[model samples]
Target: MVGSSVEGLTFDENCQVLSVTAPAGASGLPVMVWFHGGAYVTGSGESTKYDASLLALEGVVVVSVSYRLGIFGYLRDNLGLLDQLVALRWVRDNIAAFGGDPSNVTAFGQSAGADSVYALMLVSDEPLFHRAILQSAPLGARGPERAEMTAALREFVSVDASTSVDDVLAVQKDALSMASARFSPSGGMPFGPVLGEIDLAPAASRIELLVGHTADDASPYVPDQPEAWEIATELVFAGPARQLAADWTTAGGQAATFDFRWRPANAPLGACHCMELPFLFDPAGWSHAGMLAGQEPDPVLAKTVRSLWTGFARNGMAALPSRSLELGE
Candidate 1:
């Protein structure tokens, strides 16, 4: 996968942005900008599990982004909404160079990354992208409250209540380092989109959405607990796991929901949180033991997922070619 770097003009301190290109010359392909999931802390643009070459081969330009993670990104006034907004703005301006349609871009993410996509949809009225795909992420009470985040930031940075904002800014890096170290014990930085504000508001009724969860999503994150799945379902789905369908129905948004309950032959659970990625990216030789083992290319599932994604990017509605709904009708 050939690629190039573009420096973001607006933020001089930001890293040089990298975008992978398709073998087909950059001309008029739809762009898919991906955000990696690491609980908003770890992970990078260069994960082997997220190789976009397959999607690029399918006549779409795929760009995986690197954003400030952990304290650097999420320990902010507004839960790093500004950083994501900057990334979206950058994609809108520069993706055209890599054969992507700037006007036909889609934002896709998993886990915390999925939260970012929903946050972007909620906050941005500008419509930087045509559509969004959120995987295994449900609304949480932890997002979109700037003052709460600011207080957390103060604790994260270890600034005295009397410290000036300029002093806080001066010690930001040291604070970030300390905060990153202390994050896990303190339950990590409270990061996610801010709500009700213009920059991080909820999506309006007209916005199209594709939202779903895996049957065993909670297993990997919290292993060995019999009730982990139940807890996760209740916390994320906003009630019992069974009632998610009803909750989604009451939300009054245009969306297609999938259960993704089909696990592989050797796996115990169907469709864990990050399971759909290999099917999307076709990670052939990568050795990520947790998620990418024995993941052979499923042309049928790949075609279905990518076609739905691209179709949504083009028309704000994802239609599978198989004509069968993977989730219940």
Candidate 2:
């Protein structure tokens, strides 16, 4: 619970509200709202790992938001996404009270959270935020067909369409496990935004984007199976991100892309999934890098990563020094 004290000040009773971290004596600064990752099955904006206080201290009002998860979040027309939208609305309407500039907002997220950021890019109406950082979004994961999605929910959860709302939540843990096994057609986890076309409503809120994936983000899951790993990575993270970059740039938008190739010494992992997290959060005062190779975070790498992200938020572009961004100019 790194920023537990700061988070407790803003979260709502249901824990669905946004947790904010503001620098002391700040005024009219940029805002950076964050989303957490958990495959849409689990995760909370309240999670300590997401505490962006260090980033907040850089003079921006850093906000980490909580949303509905798993069956509760995705089954009902993607309630979790709606939850995020509501949070964004809240930020748009009230962040100024917290000393944040509503018009200069940067919404960023990782993994499932990153999926939400990417989806938000397509939001056509008066957008809540102006810029976005989509880190490791699995755009290739299509939404399940209505029939396929609900059948598993109905059978495994032991509830029919008319089942009492109370009964839907009574599903057992074992049932969840069973559903996961069947739901994931791809090698990775199955849960994300539903697939559908949303013609954007014209507006001034075209989202400026910065996107990337860790070099070996998907290796752990399918190491032994080369073909599986390649397919999963392409369909889940890498390929779609690149395509989105191309599409956005083609549409005359500034969309910067990168490949996080920082290799940690503790484990054999090579810039694997979630490895870029510590740097983003600037886990200051935290000496150990946890599972990221059991080594102290390299001060050089940590400083560069933070500078890059914060710089992006401040400039609405990937404007960082050469050392700050690995894929340098």
Candidate 3:
């Protein structure tokens, strides 16, 4: 919403928004649409953490999208995923005006955002984008069933259309507490795209896929429990990603996979969840994020990773190594 807009285009007041960044004097460039990750409770495309200017400088048109979060996005329905679908339709129609080739678009995300991208692919009837990049997607942390969510919500205060946003958020927090207590063992989110509500089938066409996870993605969450860290990482991030990539290939689709093992020097978390983000985007955008451990991404490595991403977007043929990728300290 902070970038150029098409005349007569308007978004509803529920905050379904997107921001665009295109290189100067560029035309017919590949487009990358991003969805942010925050366990389905936080994050937005407008946040400084997602600035796309550096990505656009790589000669692609970058669009960062924001959809509803928390109860508004998931409790009543999977509105967040629908909101992403709408954003994709918008890009399909208007991205050409921003010097993007609508036919050559990639949908990418991290964590919950990556899960949303996978959900979008399952529900979309048309090929809205040509490729997908799912980074650290918690494919194992699927949302709970509608009945379970309803039961959880019953433990909190009820709300009506007239309820204040603050009041609704307060109730939502309580509901999440209840839901997490009931579902955390299975890696379920309190509010996100729900399961067993709709029959999910693969998209009409096999999308080119690049799916991967960090080597020590769960270290931050269970730092004191090394065994728990390993189990959680495999159950929630790495294992599912590997299976998905394998299935995609078995289904005769082009797929690439990577395991990021580069940890910041002296960082306690190792190559934890979201560690790859700094390499994909501008390091400055993520400077204040404690996860990066006060270190900037290696410029040489960042360039290499971004180039690999761009190469995949251009032709869907970048065969990233299946082994762990490490950076020198």
Q: For every model in order, what is the number of clashing pairs? A: 8, 2, 0
Q: Please list the C-alpha lDDT of all candidates, in the order they appear.
A: 0.59, 0.69, 0.76
Residue range 1-329, candidate 3, lDDT tens digits: 01122223343337798899999987999999999888787777776767678788888999999898877777676888889999999999999999999999999999888988888877766879988889988887663454555556655658878988887889878777777676763334666776554432254245888888888887776788867877889988888888887777776676777788887777777788888888887777677667667878888888888877776777676534443334333
- Deviation in angstroms for 115 in model 1? 0.8
lDDT: worst 10-residue window of model 1: 1-10
Full ranking by TM-score: 3, 2, 1
Model 3, runs deviating above 4 Å: 1-13, 143-151, 154-157, 185-188, 195-204, 318-329
Report the lDDT tens digits of candidate 2 across residue range 260-326: 7776564554566777787777554333444465555566776777677777788866464431234
TM-scores across all candidates?
A: 0.73, 0.82, 0.88
Best of the candidates, TM-score: 3
Predicted candidate 1 versus true structure: per-residue lDDT over 78-170, tens digit per residue:
535576677788878877777778888878887777778777776667868766777766554243343454466667565655876556556
